[model samples]
Target: MRDEIKGIRPPSNPAAIKDALDDIARIRGRPLVYPFIGSGRGRGALVELADGSVKWDWITSIGTHFFGHGDPEMTRAVLTVASADVPIQGHLQPNGEYVEFLRAVSSIAPGRCKHVWPSMSGTMANENALKIIRQRHAPAFRVLAFENAFAGRSALMSEISGSAANKKGQPDMGQAHPVPFYDPADASSVDRTVAAMDDAFKKHPGEFCAMHVELVQGEGGFRDAPREFFQAVFERCRRERVAVWVDEIQTFGRIGEYFMLTRLGLEEWADVVTIGKMLCGSAVLFSSEYNPDPGLVSGTFAGYTAGLALGAHVIRRLRADGLIGLQGKIRALERAVSERLQVWKSDRLIRDYTAVGAMAAFTPIEPDLDSIRSMVRKIFDAGVCVYYTGHGPYRIRVLLPGGCMSTDELKEGFDIMERCL
Candidate 1:
């Protein structure tokens, strides 16, 4: 079986992969993250790179492959769709996958979320969310979002995101107002955040249509907002009639709870929710009250047929495996990572760590961008793959697919990380 799987992977031509990367860089007119290509041979927690080298995939394609690479069930689901010759693009004709996939997503959504708008990417899902909010609250131009929030790469969402860097060289929508996110131990954090939102609301009274939050910021350093903090913020948005748009692009399935709104107890207040990454298909789940007018939300491609099938399979499998249920794999991985952090705390090289379920991030004591990047590269070279987050004070963020990885496997990856450090 191992040999058969190996044969199924990409041609083990390291030189060919390297040459392709060079060609891509030359064509795109910029340097790229060279020397890495997925071989599609990985099973569970490990991946075989195009260079014929195997490494523990701690990043899991930036939380997209939540079940890890070459998962048998995922493969089977995709193969089933492929065998049927389902159209790659399904916009012209409605398919059963669309209905079944939406049903699967709706099953997990809050009761009020009666409508689902399918899109090709997280950005488009968010874009649709904004469109729905705009249609529901016409002429209400302003939006509310947390500090360092990341929405998507699209022009409109780039404006909605809190990062100024993302909006560079793009025309500003100039509609999103930034507010402070929750800090767990900070007693005054909630008040400070509320004050920010209140100030923003007062500045643009009746102009704010919606507020988007990650609940747990993913790219912004995996920081989490406490339940009380989220509840207080949601209350303010509700009072101001601002639709709550939660961006679960990176936080969806990997957060252990399947949905961060539910994990953070903000599901009831979630007027619009955007989900992507591990689910394969990205979508916006909105309440009936926020449904948009016709011609407002449409896409050329909702998602690929295989992704749609695999998404439904993933949702069902995760539920059956209890990976998203209480004290499940998410919590188990969190505990494992937390235990490791506890031991690393005594190490002078370790600065701080944050372990939130399946996502974990840590910073070095003497941190710099170059050092962080070098450390990540070293970790990858040392047979484990992780990623970096944040700027100025960067962190090593590891998004492990705990549902498919064992605690011992996690320890082994951490061991490689330690050796790399």
Candidate 2:
């Protein structure tokens, strides 16, 4: 299996594939972020590009494809749904697969999470969560989000997101207050952040409906918000009556245990949790107290039937296999990677590294976005596909495929990364 997957090659006419991709990008009036093009062909951790080039996909569809691409079980679940001939829409007409998916999700959710509302993507899930917060806490339209945090790119979500660039031309969708996230390396970060949250409440007294946070920030450069920090913030939110909404969109299935919040022991305080990406679907899990009335959060398409089915399967496996949690395989994999990163700490080029759960980033000593981009391109040229994130001090982040890779496979990937560097 390894030989077959590793031997996969790029398309004979790589340039033609890139040209076609460029043409399509131009037609769409958008530039390609990465020159790479997908061929819709992938097996395990490898993806075949339109150019016929097969590269080890470290991004894993940006943290989707938890079990890697084209898993037999996922494919079978999808095929069964496809063969059913029933309509894919689940809001008006509930699908058995979607029902199972919700059950699985609700079971793993720390709090009651008695109410589950499915959406098509992470952004929609977050948007719907915000709607729920508004419905439950009427007259409170403002939101509290952390700086460098990412919610999504939808109209409302763009404003909620930390990046101003995502909402550059977009009109304001909601009242958002961005506070600094906790940086353990910074001695006074927690105190300052807590103070900021307090100030936001005072400035907009009774105006905030929800406090949205990514326990382990993903697109915001894979940073972690310490337990003490979260505890402190949650205390303030509780006092202010602001609903705590944990956005596990990127860190859900990939993180330690079932969810990052749960891993951090903060689920008890979270009123609503939005999850998506590798779960095969997205949904908002809220306490019964926050559950909205009918029509408050309903969508035409709850989720893809196949994806819903596969999502249920994925959740079941994660629960049964014990790949998460404190002593879980995922945690072990994270430790392994952390240890490997230490070997490069002494190297002058590598400034530092940060990881939480399956997400990690290697920071350079002297940061340069263009240099990191060049490194990524060179890494791709070296036959290992990876990506970079964050601005100014960009990092070569690793979203590991733990479900598919063993210790040896992971070490091999690390070795490849080192060679590329």
Candidate 3:
């Protein structure tokens, strides 16, 4: 461990933490599973809790904190924007920070996705992307998405997402057309998906506007598919004249590329893309061909000024520090995690492991939801913070701090997980 985070220890004031959690539960009308509250101080991947305990924060707020906590560059970026006239930039009037953020995102975005629109969250970015695509392909309101894909939780997005639980009790929008996602374990996964696509298109000809894909499904259990799988899917979309929308909200930056499409050699297939999480602010990047008409997609708040500054800074810093590319820090950490997971799999401690760059997940020996929940709680109590994904047979997910966490620290986290297991 680094000298700064060497003081990590178990909680010394459980009573105080319980009291705070009680207050939180009262205010939110529900209780948190882990009862976590940050002390507003941390170093790299290690964060201190309000109750005087420190834990390895491997999830990084569901892949938002790319550089982890208390990063000097990130801190400097925030301080630089702290003196801005307005805290939040808006569509009607945006500051230079917004322009700079756009420039930064555009500089690293796929060449075809030239136009950029910044938003406050990934869901809003997806909403904008949806509006743009739907406007371009009017009368074709249905969207094609993969099964087990998670778009977001907005009313429209809930309809579009593959999760039935998310859309429960809500009026059906009847706009989503889900096909099976790629299954690496199945030899005919690609062919099956292609067949399903053909079936959907044949059944509802000229009714689909776009196909939304997560190159690496984050909330859907950190699963990934081979490039060939995406190539086949995108080819079918192209043949049907349906727009291809890549949702890189959780995979951006953490993946060993600025854009996952660029890394997979499928950049040309992307007509529109939505990015968020690690960017600090969310954005919709689209081709000129898919740009929406005037007054179609506008929001009141663009984003916080500091977040925009940090987003730009993160882009530049990632490039400057050589944290991207095939042989970069991100892939290095991914390799380390994969190696450990492989060993555990061999030992039958884990059933299977899936990963793409820093986003990873592994099914525990006891894969039931209740067992997985118990294991996660134990892991948290043992000084590591991780989350689970998927339904039924759950898998523990980890979003490593690729920019700030060292291999040694990652191994330490694995050790904690093993102890919990």
Candidate 4:
């Protein structure tokens, strides 16, 4: 462990932090939950803020920094690409780094996904996937999405997302239809989902083009279902001739597998998939059958040169470091965190403890949005930064940096959480 991560302490420069927060709030039109301003320096899972206080970053930028902050390997990758002639790569003229990134991702992609399209963000990748599906099955514009699914924030994606708040004030595209996700508490959960899917197909008849599966719902409180449920859903889509699109944007590298579908043994059913966050850059992977025409999907910027290099390096390191199987380091961390959470649940400190690989979440005993938000703020103030997900009964979501976070550091974070509770 590094010296800065030894322990957490109060901010030394409160006035300076307050000034910076004020400036940021004035410019952004809203105050943040915590006055967090990074000092651009970190070691392992610990980051130093502008106020000279270091905290354990359990959320890892919502799963973007899988290797944690200031990873030496990632730093070297970025530096190697810094001298590129152009800062950003584009569709018309891509550099060698772009091709390298595609090859790196392709090396791990399912055999069905033979074609790849690069994009700047997850939303763009999802947009490209939607377009390819739509073009392949024209006039069949409707989509099948889970009730609490969160695709992205683009115009089409916002409409497709299951949150009404996200689609507020925007005209309803009426393109996405909802189906209930699996509930472990219900004995007939699998059958119930299949029935709902069947009803949608019957009602819409050939109007549906694809089904979006999150595998492990990120914004939906890290909730996940068993493989049996997914197999049933995929079978229904197959019978209906509706394409299966897996959105692994948030679950890609953190789920103890390069792709969650592969882990579930459902990769063969996936026609198109989108990945991002932990990959540094986002991309859409599809089968040759769904490949779009030349003029259908094109973007000005693929991504930054350094970002592509860093993404490729992350993938390579993940494979070489033995961090990607069912018995990998990611799963080991998940088990450690789940054990601590179980103790808290038994003690009545929390409820609904849910975990998969590096992602874990639990709802507070109170189970209200305001109360959960308060708990998150308290945890951040106590030296570990975590965020909340879902509504009705929000959960405190924990996303660990699977590649670098150690067991001892993880214990320290749970100790802080216990103290806060």
Candidate 5:
């Protein structure tokens, strides 16, 4: 660690970064601590913190770095764009790169979402998507998201989320509603939940504009709605001409397919779809209807030229590499681990174990923020990188990227996690 720091050009003060974070906390009126100290080397799926610790990366820039940082091709693409981007920033500069990238992303979009409204972050992209719902259709078009489904942190997203913290200062849409999500493990629980959603539809009737969802619900503790239930939801939405939105911000790409609905066959049933985190690799994506009105939804920095170039290049590479065909490799890895590890026995504190694609999480045998943080901190210190999606006291989540972590690396991380518990 000392050598790495000493070699850095002119040296960067570690304290300065911490000081800036503290300043931001004060400015935002929040006390959130900086979770991970990014090395910024943008190399391998690993982190070497200032304290001389090594870690395997499950948080690939929150999975945006699916190919891991320092990818030669991605690096080359970034360089290629940086040189040409000076021209993309000009006023009213419409270029083919931006349009081509949009075409590639729309080609992969689920259902009827052939057009996209790109944004700087997933939060704003979602906020824009909501406007499309309210503006195009009647203001009475209700926005419905499943309870515990977190879309983003914007005010409108907060209004859709069930958390009081997010909703506290956020304004609300009078026509929005939330339904209880379904869980299949509890037998009748899924049917009962769907029954509740069915009832909700009756209450709202023709007021619904779109039904937003994160198929796997990664933020809500890696909980996936029952496949049957999802099919039912899609059917219901189609029957009523209500938009079915699959929030692929977290679940997209990680599951082999671009969206979970593709894996579950809901793409044919969906209406509006939103995707972010690896659309053009770093650029966020929110799409609905092939082409909204020119001024229907626009952002100052949305769909910047540089990001468009990267997106176009990435889509070509993904298609050429047969990435979709590699999904079986993801499922095979999960089966191999589940079968190979005897230590993964169920316990009273173990709420569940979910592994799909490169995304996986194991609920703990008695979870808490301290316990979760301690486990993750220890993992970083011990050299296996992972994340903690806090969901009560019964989850020790591990979010791995589909193409990021190799099978051997994933097994090693799991082994370390077993010891951590």
Candidate 6:
């Protein structure tokens, strides 16, 4: 695409690749996806084009590769670990890398939370959180999840998220009501809507096992929870005797001290914290020190060599290299993007703006098919990547990892985005 790109394969025909994938999609079901991203590339964080052009990645697997794709440091660990011949599904034999990952993660993720379980994905991690919550408060069938919360696609998680559409038609869709992410942006909204959650609990009696929350609701359009509000919720959950679960899958490590929960001082408050995306850089890490028993739950690829090795490398790098406290970098980026977008707000292309740590977002006033198409197409053509969330035409999200991008690179990407708006 750019005369010649550095450090990647010669590239394959994305159209041909698309055609093959299209056939698979026919059976895969045509779910409407947001624009900006075409199909992702094989290794590098580039979106492969039909003409073989590539665009920079913004989503980063919804904030998955914290360090970056194709990081040589991670590769070294992967290559060395694959030489082993143990059956990872054995469940009982979690190797040195797995043990090392857990130990480091426990030490790094708010010392108050000293336990973690390896699972397959963000959804699995969420499921584990749900399981842990119920077990901790057995008779409590309910769990408090915010309105636009985006957990994952498991049967339980889908229900908890209140996105029944995602479930499509799953038989046992567990129930969790939507609490307003708060309406500072919505003018006609009456009152400072914080009771949306309390309203839910009133409808359904003491069945709640916990209040599963995200310090930053990334999928719900990058909403930030007031720190005091989180503290209040923790105090209430204590009174209700419900477990507190924080979905750190999307927010942890984007910035702040390792896990997002710690940013809210939720380390001591959270009874269980679920982490995925960049947790071990690949595998899902769930904590259940107060709740895990041998066969209560497990995943086929839990702490496999590949994921553990990659995760270990990522964890080790953060500790050894001081990559965890990059909050200043995030603040600067948020200021740059928000200031630029504000000028365009009157143009009505933007509906809202918000930021938490390095996780950033802005939204369309009225998100529709054509509106989404125009914004994403322009961003893609200009060579940046982003994604969508919520049942609403939520926002354009950008993930700034420690090394995958430079301040200038992210700035340049946003400069192109400004022109697109």
lDDT against the true structure, each candidate: 0.81, 0.81, 0.88, 0.88, 0.64, 0.65
Once fitted onto the true fold, the runs of candidate 3 whose alpha carbons sit more than 4 angstroms away are 1-16
TM-score of 2: 0.94
Tell me each candidate's TM-score: 0.94, 0.94, 0.96, 0.96, 0.85, 0.85
CA displacement after TM-score superposition, residue 27 of candidate 6 (Å): 4.4
**Poorest 10 consecutive residues by lDDT, candidate 3:** 1-10
Residue-wise C-alpha lDDT for candidate 4, range 118-174, written one tens digit per residue: 898999999999999999999899999998898999999987787778888999878
Tens digits of per-residue lDDT for model 3 on 1-421? 4335535555557887788899899999988978689877788898877777778998888765778887888888889889879999998899999999999999987969999999989999999999999999988989999888899999999988867689889998778988998887799999999999999999999999999999988777777888999999999999999999999998888888988898898898999999998888999999989878889988789999998898888899888888899989888888898999999999988999987788889999888989988898999999899999986568999988888888889889999998777
Sliding window of 10 residues with minimal summed lDDT for model 6:
31-40
TM-score (C-alpha, index-matched) for candidate 1: 0.94
Report the C-alpha lDDT of model 2 over 1-421, residue by residue, as the tens digit: 5446535664557567667877978899996657677766678777776666667778887766677777787778877788776647568888688779888887787776667888889999998899988998999999999988799998788888877688899887658889998877789998999899989989988999989998887877778867999999999899999999999988887877778887887878999999888887889999999988888888678887877887788888776777877898788888998888888887654888887767889886655888888888887876677777775577888787767767777777778878867
Please write out the lDDT profile of model 5 over residues 353-414, one tens digit for every residue: 77766677776665777777776777666666677663464355555555544677667766
User: Each model's RMSD to truth, in Å?
Assistant: 2.1, 2.1, 1.9, 2.0, 3.7, 3.7
**Candidate 2: which pairs clash?**
10-52, 10-53, 11-51, 11-52, 11-53, 257-325
lDDT of 5 at 213: 79
TM-score of model 4 vs. true structure:
0.96
Residues 1-421 of candidate 6 have per-residue lDDT tens digits of 3344423545466566666566556876762243222433423444454345667777676655556655667778778877788625324667787777777676676634566777767888788767766775678778777777888876678777756576677765456765656555575332233456567667776877788788888667677855667777677677767777778888766654577766666678877777767755333334445556667776566766777766666667765655555444444555665666676676676877776666777777767646665677678778776666555665766775544556666667777887777
170 Cα displacement, candidate 3 (Å): 1.7
Model 5 Cα displacement at 64 (Å)? Answer: 2.2
Would you list the clashing residue pairs of candidate 1? none
Q: Which 10 consecutive positions of candidate 4 have the poorest summed lDDT?
A: 1-10
